[model samples]
Target: MDEPARRGRLPLPHRGIAFGGDYNPEQWPRETWAQDARLMREAGVDLVAVNVFGWAEIERSPGVYSFEELDSVMDLLHEHGIAVNLGTGTSTPPPWLTTAHPEVLPVTREGETVSPGGRQAWCPSSPVVREHALRLVRATAERYGDHPALALWHVSNELGCHNALCYCDESASAFRRWLERRYGTADALNAAWGTSFWSQRYGSFDEVLPPRLTASAENPTQLLDFRRFSSDELLEWYRAEAQVLRASTTTPVTTNFMVTAHIDTQDYWSWAPDMDVVANDHYLDHRLDDPWAELAFAADATRGLAGGAPWMLMEASHGAVNWQPRNLAKAPGELERMVLTHVARGADAVCFFQWRASRAGAERFHSALLPHAGTDSEQWRATLRLGALLDALDEVVGTRPTSDVAVVFDWQAWWAVDAGGHPTQDVRYLDEVHAMHAALRRAGVGVDVVSPDTDLSGYRLVVVPTLYLVSDEAARSVERFVVGGGHLLVTYFSGIVDENDHVRLGGYPGAFREVLGARSDEFFPLDDGESVALDDGGVGRVWTERLEPRGATVRARFTDGPVAGGAAVTRHEHGRGAAWYVATRLGTGGRDALVTDVLEGAGVRPVLPGAGGDVDVVRRDGDAGSYLFVVNHGDDAFVARAPGVDLVTGRRADAHEVPAGGVAVVREQPTGRRRPSEEAPA
Candidate 1:
């Protein structure tokens, strides 16, 4: 038994929240440069990510480079005491490169080459594109590697955002090679992909190509492997540039990850290892009608990727992003809530998408710290106030949240559960996971959304929802946890497949049947808007399974359905712990009831006893002691007694009332110099 290696560290001089974000001086006039610095300084901005999309301005043509304009921007920001998160500017290749080398452009699934008007239009596996991107990175590193204000080496902008699924000939070749390495031979690949289902079997690796424009739906396993390959391909590109930066400087290297549930091109669990600090750009998906909950979940997921270490909020919208269908601006005080939520989770730094507003291009309407209305605008003032508030809460940095409960929300499960051939197409792994997590949050319980590969010994209760893909090793680990007195709750569609998307034999939920003391006979998927009544006065929708209790105690039964009176939920008492199986999609009310029972059985409690459902509470353990962050996302006022002094205001009161869309961070009174726990975040 040995401790895991320490995760990556931040590149700043000390543990302090970096406060600025993507700065594009190339888009503005030189006259506004000094004004940018003045405004940043006034806002207490300490970092700026520059050169993110400046490929054209950096290198006008092949074999040619210019640093005069960038030098001015960098020097000006440095003079004002603002550090730089220098990007390689390879996200968007200049039009000259795309025009000269059209082969480097990405091709759609239908084989049409994508034009270079938008960003991330280059093929990730294109040798020509990789060579040029590496060259630019090396040149940038050699020039600014030792700059006085170099805080972080931003390898490239968000990887795999637009060009994740390139179907060009080059990608096809690369995908074939990746398959060959993964499976060793085409026969093994055919077996894994189950190509025999369509009477199509590959005799050689070359026969396999990127799944595109097939006569029918592509092979589920083939599509999954391609997703992995695409993510790894982009990761390799980032690693290449990161190597160049590490060779030239000591600055930590990272590329922002789109870890939101909406974007799934990159598997951040695999990509996180290459980054020195797991930085992520999270934008609220307003379509969900619960952007606050999504933001919290994204932060939790990103922190899990970072191994519970302090990560960075690289790019969040100042108000609304221009990309979404309907861009709604953030209400007053909403910015503070969004930023503090990340800080309350595990973010050491909070930054936005841009420092100033854009006047042209696709993002001109996107909000910024300095809006088009200038310094007198509400956005500017709100940003300024946020920066000052962050400066006062330096003690919150480098802390990790300790949770009594963990939700096993595997990304692989997310990918596999939604693939074709599922019993119910309407079932979404993320949606179910969010429902479970939201239940815990509403109950005022702290939760850590972790990967299945994570150790389960630290948690009292481990919740799994729609874990459609489970490896044998992970299954054994869960079994060991329950045997060692850890409560386990697994939902439907779990333990059905191995890592290769192959079904496990014996019964449904193959790997976990014994642990749960139950077996599912068959799946009964409900039609749209259909639901079954539960014995507990709750409704189960989307899916249900006929469960035959082996050695488990039936917890709940279906009141009316094809399998009426059958077990809908069961709890099995193992050697020293307990295991629960939920065999249906229990919509909100049902889910909340099940979660409440499990939490009560496990004795898990919330940070604040009387905290409202809309008031999110999280505790972070740092060198300074435990800090409680109480954030109210509701409209009404909420009150929570302070455990220590409020970090934002130097006030110490028995009760602290926060207004709607407000936040409060209180440091717990020290108990004679207690040491912070070094346990990894669950």
Candidate 2:
């Protein structure tokens, strides 16, 4: 809230959710702007994002600026009573600039320097690139500084573009400088990147190699360093615009991260701190249940980034996207429910990719508020319904839920696993992480998706999934939590590796093995359809391992199978507390059962009672306040048997069974007690 307020508004604005999508008047004729605005009003769209990729139009030639078109667009939107989120137009380098300043282009993993056309194609480390990029930003802000319609400043389209960059002399030199700023000298850099392994010793700062094809990522440390470097590279870019944008204009600045993204390769835990609010282009893969889980976790993670402040869904589909092999339409109440579900979690706004459908391009068939032939289509009706809901909710967008349980979502570990050469590639990090998180939500546990670096003392229970890399400091943090008599859950692959993607050098599940009360000597990576029987734990596929106990008790062992006596799950007593380890990849049911058992033991249950299925009910109950957000994920029409009156209508959610894809928002009355924070400020 401090950061958001500093940027000039409540996280989502106390008024309610923003209802608008990306609008590009530059793509069409001037005549079309009026029709688009009229249609936007009819669709209940209130906020419009513009100038996202108008580099060519904004800058017709070098040193010659043309923002007249943009000025008119912003003014008209303001006249229409729509809030504007003006972008910096730096995502793509203008064709003229790219043709002249070829060095501004980025180097690919294959060591090929690109020639522009694509977005985020500029080398982040290139001074020339930064100069021109920041110039555009300062120019836009200076011109539109006092505009009332100007609400937020979208820095660049997607900071996530293909490949790690700056393999050129400029980047190499910049990389050296970056290293100097991070680690003091060549020796520190050597240790951090483990350069001694390949005899790749750097005699001087100039001798170091960029993490490109030329460097050859044969060493795991090299690859990981490149990952770190690339993330930092993106961070540098985000910080640049944020710094300049905040100088004169006090608009909230945000860049979109693609949630569960594999290609862009950024660690949000590291990047999120710089933002006023975290925004992501959250496009779901065709799989619906997985989408629901991902949305919940991602939204929670964004909110939890800064003391559970609401985040923005910078991009959503009005209907479907062209990229998915099978793009499916949103079901009856699905879109509206999905919108409300994000609100329930902690979302300030939800914006679609484009305001109107494209007549051409890769995204021509992509979903939009206005179909290819603009009208009040099913999607438009869906958008309207959500807007109507927000109208009814009356600005629940920026409200922060004071009560929450921290569920550690370690992206560092997630990245380490993805980079590490696992016994099998079939093991799904995204799926597994989501499954456990979904279970916690289903049990009505108000979750705070956090990282190992997050402060953990506030939470009664902390759950870590597939924690492959456990830094000594992070381990001690967990130890402190357990020592303070807090509950802990560490699952398989929990502590098998270090930062270098190297195993702990002892038995499998090495360091966490003791914390988990067992050690695995062998790991089995099964085919997708294959299954290994779990005694009380449940059978699983993808990855399974056998454990040897040092201390702690075996909770579940494989039953009636080849590894009948092997450990599947274990519990250990460490420093006046308990730690649970789930050692296998269970299907949804089995995973839920394991997680639910742990939650029940801790006596920290979901707000909703008894066997809930796909519906994820999370309650934020505390002295400050209590909020119950219920989400239904199953395809079939499902009713959430939640206990509480709907805060919006004051009607009991139990009176009428909610429709499938439906959600209920219940604000519970807090008892006569004050929060710890109320007693003492953090």
Candidate 3:
């Protein structure tokens, strides 16, 4: 593929993790801009994300659009030598558009209509919404298409609006178009929705109703279909703007997604294909965040998606934000350590929310390179330390993560689980996915988190927990991988349904019966706090469906219970590989043990082991060799026995371990085609 085939590239200035932060000059004066630039120079900040929330100022009330202020800001930034992550600034609706067309008002889940009160408050499904958003996108691209100061395009602002989407008129129509394309016929729709059961079969397209909270969700399939519709609708929205940038501009494009919060916004699997590079926002309430578990998997998953493409730490914090109860300052060197973790995981650049904190707005209390207290604050000092580090290692920005072993998780499946209103409300995909991730780290496995749609043949093994929707295509990909001797592990709920959210009624595991070897007839739900003990005596909440397997050998089953004999876990062999299934939500111990068994069965391990549980390990897949990131997330001393050159010191590990809360990036031996430089990120 040519560079800028779909998403353009943010030409790399160098390597070793780009250091930068979001710069909202619209929030402050030009004098503050110089000071911000000075602080950035001190912190080694190289890129600034401009125009994320500037729609009101840039296109002041439609026809009266003016870029004079933005022109000056861009000119000054160019003079400062800081590359720019340009934004189209379509997140918040400019008051003029909303006031003129109130139909763009976003609808709530319960049908509680909203008046635009905050950023991202506009309806995504509204035609008027899409129309205006596109105008801004096109306008921005036309005006700044080949600006020399540009680094990349940060399309829309943070992208997800807490999953509250447009339930307005236009979205409903768009949802129908998507359904028509996917199902082809009303009969197919009826079958997919099992509409006959509820006497809800539609006679015509117009009769097709949305799965609103008050409407279609009466059936599980209805709810699932709605979830699919909503996600696809948003995907279309992102794609439309992406198409705009791809057609009119030379810069790579991406919108920042919130880190694995509700529904995995900018979910790498769903959205990465559209990104020139991936960018995400990461923040926590200070006290403690299992940085490795929660954020690492998200990052690895994204890196894996763009086929190991480079990504940026688009947004981070200079200090604690106003949201947390204790807006604690990031003590001294805390910022540097956090940035290192992101780089070790595979971030090409780093930037905070505000270049300088908002002087007087909602985010006035938010952390930034420059703060409300002005020039000489503790937060400002931390920014300086970060800048110094970025300056020292200016050669590795816009680099990719080199990895192996793509762990398969799917949004379709995730959506199914969520909308299925699973018999158990406690079934959590992120938690289960994280458990496996934690186990891989413990065993020192170079883990690459991925989705079912992601390419699997590159890795030796692919593990998918509760792959409820193994679309035929995704199933074929897995089959092809296994046929070629790649390992496959598919857990309970392996098949269940198809892409349209319809159950695979012929038997269980609709699409993957042969590959997984398990046929589930009926599985009963187990409520929270209740569990079937593993054969090893470890117990946990049996989140959903007690398994009844046929053809597959039981690996683990609910012990000491009425459903004890039912297959709670099973394994089967196919072609040159094997697949396994877990029927219950095992506690951490059981989950870890189960994952260990699977990885061991696949014959994969981290190049270096025995670094202890606190050292979070991840492998970034790239061209010639991969970069292994070993992060010490625990409180005690974490001794990381480095596998290759410690990228941090340009030296190998002298001792067999690193100190507590330390990190190491090791170079993995090369294999396969040297990955070519591509515009899109993994």
The C-alpha TM-scores of every prediction are 0.97, 0.91, 0.88
For residues 1-682, could you state the per-residue lDDT of candidate 2 as single tens digits?
Answer: 2554633324432266777889988878999998887777776677888999888898888767898988888888877788887898888888787788887787765777787655667777778878888998888889998788888888887775563445776777777776778778888777766677768877767776666664344666666666677788878888999898889877778888776534437877788778877777776666555676677777777676655765777888867788777898777767766676666766667788889888866688898877765454666666666667666664354456543357777666766677645777776566667777787777666678888877788766788887777786777788788777667887777777677666677787776655666777788667667888876646776777767767878877777444668777778888877788877787777887877777656556455554256766655443345566666666655455555566545686444355566766665544543332233322
* Alpha carbon lDDT at 565, candidate 2: 80
* Best TM-score among the predictions, by candidate number: 1
- Model 1: weakest 10-residue lDDT segment is 673-682
Winner by TM-score between candidate 3 and candidate 1: 1
Where is the poorest 10-residue window by lDDT in model 2?
A: 673-682
> Scored by CA lDDT, what does every candidate get?
0.86, 0.72, 0.68
Tell me each candidate's RMSD, in Å, in order.
2.7, 3.7, 4.4
* TM-score winner between candidates 2 and 3: 2
C-alpha lDDT (0 to 100) for residue 616 of candidate 2: 67
Candidate 1 global CA lDDT score: 0.86
Segments of candidate 2 deviating more than 4 angstroms? 1-14, 163-169, 214-217, 261-264, 287-289, 402-404, 500-508, 521-530, 559-564, 619-627, 635-654, 667-682
Cα error, residue 386 of model 2, in Å, equals: 2.2
TM-score rank order: 1, 2, 3
